[model samples]
Target chain A: MKINLALAQINTKLGDVEANLAKHLEYIEKAKAEKTDLLVFPELSLTGYVLQDLVASVAHKPVEDDPVFKHILAASRDLDLVVGFVDEDSRHRFYIASAYLSGGKLVHVHHKVYLPTYGLFDEGRFFAWGDAVRAFDTRFGRVGMLICEDFWHASPPYLLWLDGADIMLFSSASPGRGLNDKEKLESARWVERVTKAYASMFTSFVVHSNRVGYEDGLHFWGGATAFDPNGEELAHGPYNEEAITYTQLDLNQLRRTRARLPLLRDERTALVQKELDRILNRG
Target chain B: MADINLTLNTDLARDILSGFIKSEITRVGLSRAVIGLSGGLDSALSCALAVAALGRENVLAVRMPYKASSKDSLDHAQLLIDQLDIPNKTIEITDMVEPLFQLDPDISNMRKGNIMARERMIVLYDQSEVFKGLVVGTSNKTEILLGYSTLYGDSASAMNPIGDLYKTQVRQLSRAMNIPAPIIDKPPSADLWADQTDEKELGFTYEEADKLLYLLVDQRYSPQEAVEAGFNKKFVDTVTTRIRRNQFKRMQPPIAKVSNRTIGYDFLYLRDWGT
Candidate 1:
């Protein structure tokens, strides 16, 4: 199947949820016009990153009775929308999350697991770590969602691939500065390389979306990208520029790539699991 | 090894350092200054500038080493003293700091680190009292930006000559001074913990981080612009987050406003005290 994917790169303000939602709705309309089968957005695209303490107050809880998300559910009735936001659980701990919407209902939500704590990041200070990886059944295919820093590691994407996700989508709010354009592009290239190598290794497609804007002394570099099931670059957006780009990915090519490279067929998961156990134990 | 640039050359740095010392000394009306010499680049640079401006006899270099401090650091610090031939003394602080740790065994590594820093500062300040001198600081601009130094510990000083220079720039000045090659080439550390390195804790090299910081904080590059300029987005985000998160460390403690112009309240005045 040939699937149309859209990457929305837009500017966002810190703690401005309503304005950011309005922007997301506008972008959704644009993506709808392009007739995209899937639409992806950057991390924290709703309330922006570096909102500090405001995350507790502004984070949205996915309630069946909540009107804001109800409106999103209504608007996304016809299209597949993947957007980033903050989710508040019952424990009151906030999570960096990506919501998947399809056919006017909430399909699945994935919480960010890797909370960066060192220099220039206090994610550990503000948000709690998520425990599970979620995949959803979609009209295009079985899709998986990951937040920023999730796709940086190879394990999450590999797990999603194993869980029967034919397409993997990443939403990120990657900061930009000093030769960061090349760095971001190179990083994207690395992600593409890994996804393609892994996609060919696993027979899947990978799509990534990033944001653009300056918030609290940091700038988000928007360079949304997509790789085919064969791990080739199907499309890429400009770094630091707000844009929406689309590409068509054919599912048939995934089978061809998988057939050509049958690495997954002859894999050793037990040994890999043992190695993972060793790494985690060492940590 | 990266080629270090101060951005401000030796002559310019000398002028800036001298001017900062002269103005601060005049403002405080102090003829003598005391420094806690760690044998590290930051302290060495600060002590050198202080000696040049106030004369060797007026500047006191106090080396306060604990149990964990490397002998190389002491030897290098002695080399700086002997080379400059400044008035100096070595005070073993292990006896003083060990008791506090014994009293509270649950004291965190962070707390222990702070105690080590504060112990040294206590010695420096006590010496200041004996010598009638002001405590000169060794913190650099990068440390201040990241809030890496301990407040009232390494962060507390009357004035810092090298506070405006980044770590990369400090290395440049160190090289220009022909200060021993070992001191210039050695990795930066507080020596609070054995085999500890600053960059390892910070998650990026000073050269990479300082360049990112200069563009983000100084040049006002947006995160997107920074990424476009070839910096890693994750690294950029990390550096920018640190700068924002540590903003509190850059300012005086917050106080409830009662007066029209309290010290850190409405009374916020320009730091150009002497000028």
Candidate 2:
């Protein structure tokens, strides 16, 4: 099957949900015009990142009746949409989350399991830890979502792959840091390498959408990118600028690559699980 | 010991810094910037960047020269103003600061210099209000790290574009941006007194200091480790001591924790909150 995806690399106002909602609607309309099958926004697309004390105020439940999700769900009737926001549970605990809405229904909600607290990030100080990493059925295929730091660790995406996800949608509000001789940011280059490696290793399509513009002193280099199951870069957005990049993803590439490699088919989950159990419970 | 590479991709740096200046200023409902140009490299680069971000018409460069400030200082500033074609004002601060100087007949050079800097800051802020612009700062990373600036004087600003660039890095970028040759090549100075130059006052060249600082601060080297990295042990000790001693100049006044969430301690929110 072939799927059309739109990676929206946008600039968001810090802690302003209303203005961000308008921007999402505008991007959805543009994606629809381009006949996109799925539209993905960067992490914290609804409420901006760096919301230390303001996280609770911007948090919302991604239910059908939610003031923000209602418009998003309505837009999903035309095409599937993935958006990032602060998710509040029944007990008022907040998580950095992404929700996938398709056919006017919330299909999957992924709470970011890893909140990086080191070196310029303060997500752990304000957000509750997420304990789930599961893939769900989407209109395109079985897909999983991971926000920023979650994908930085290999375990989450590996678990998603084991759970039968053929597509991995990774989003980030990654700030630009470290300059290289090639004029590319160190952070941007590292992300591109990781996403492509994951694509080739897991034999799945990987799509990454990163936000652009500045918040406080942190500059987020946009540079949204995609890789096929063959680990070939299919599309790349501009660096340090806002843009929407669209690419046609052929899901059949997964079948061709996996048939050749056969790494997933030869997996031994039981032995791996037993080893992990022994390592954790070692005397 | 390996050499620390401080070279920046001027194109990328220009794009990022200009975007930063534009976003930080406009997010607060202001579209213009008012910068105090010292006819030195740092201020010249800051003014050029502000013009790039907010346009030449939006940035107002103000030259606040003291009586003892060099004639070349004013002329160099005028050359930048003419080159960038930005709006400018030359405000002589001699008369404004005379009352305080006259009050102290035995005033020290440091006190007089502080008075000149604070008076220039006053002029900048007042012109910022008149021009509906925010004050932009020009202190580079080297001086900021060494506490080479007077607190609340030249250090005060609504935002700073070049604060993170070290002195040598600032010169590299300034040359790339095509700042006037005289401004970029001349010996760095505060021009606070008749013969005041930064290196002569600090007793060290910015080149040597930048390398040692990169090892100590950026590379997180200890004083012993820096000495092992080919730096003199005394240089490392002096720089580290100065950095520690000037910690107060870098931070907000601490508030006592009286509530469940104290400001800057627990009640944390970014400066771009709600904007």
lDDT of each: 0.78, 0.92
Q: Score the docking of each candidate (DockQ).
A: 0.02, 0.76
lDDT of 2 at A204: 89
lDDT of 1 by residue, A53-97 (tens): 667766896555665577677667868888788999988879999
Candidate 1 TM-score to native: 0.54
In every candidate, how many clashes are there?
Answer: 23, 0
Residue lDDT tens for model 2, B1-275: 65788888888888888899999999999999999998999999999999999999999999998888999999999989999999999899999999999998999999998889999999999999999999989999999999999898999998898988899989998998989999998999999888898999998999999999988888888899899989887888889999999999999998988888788898888899888
Off by over 4 Å in 1: A177-201, A274-283, B1-275
Q: Which residue pairs in model 2 clash with each other?
A: none
> Interface RMSDs of all predictions?
13.8, 1.2
lDDT by residue (tens digit), candidate 1, B1-275? 22323355465455446545654665456788899989899999888888777888988999999988999889999989998899998999999999999998788888899999989888999999998888888999898998898878999888777776788888887777767777888999888888888998887888888887777776777988888888888988888888899888787777887777666543422342212
Q: Which prediction has the highest DockQ against the true structure?
A: 2
lDDT of 1 at B235: 89
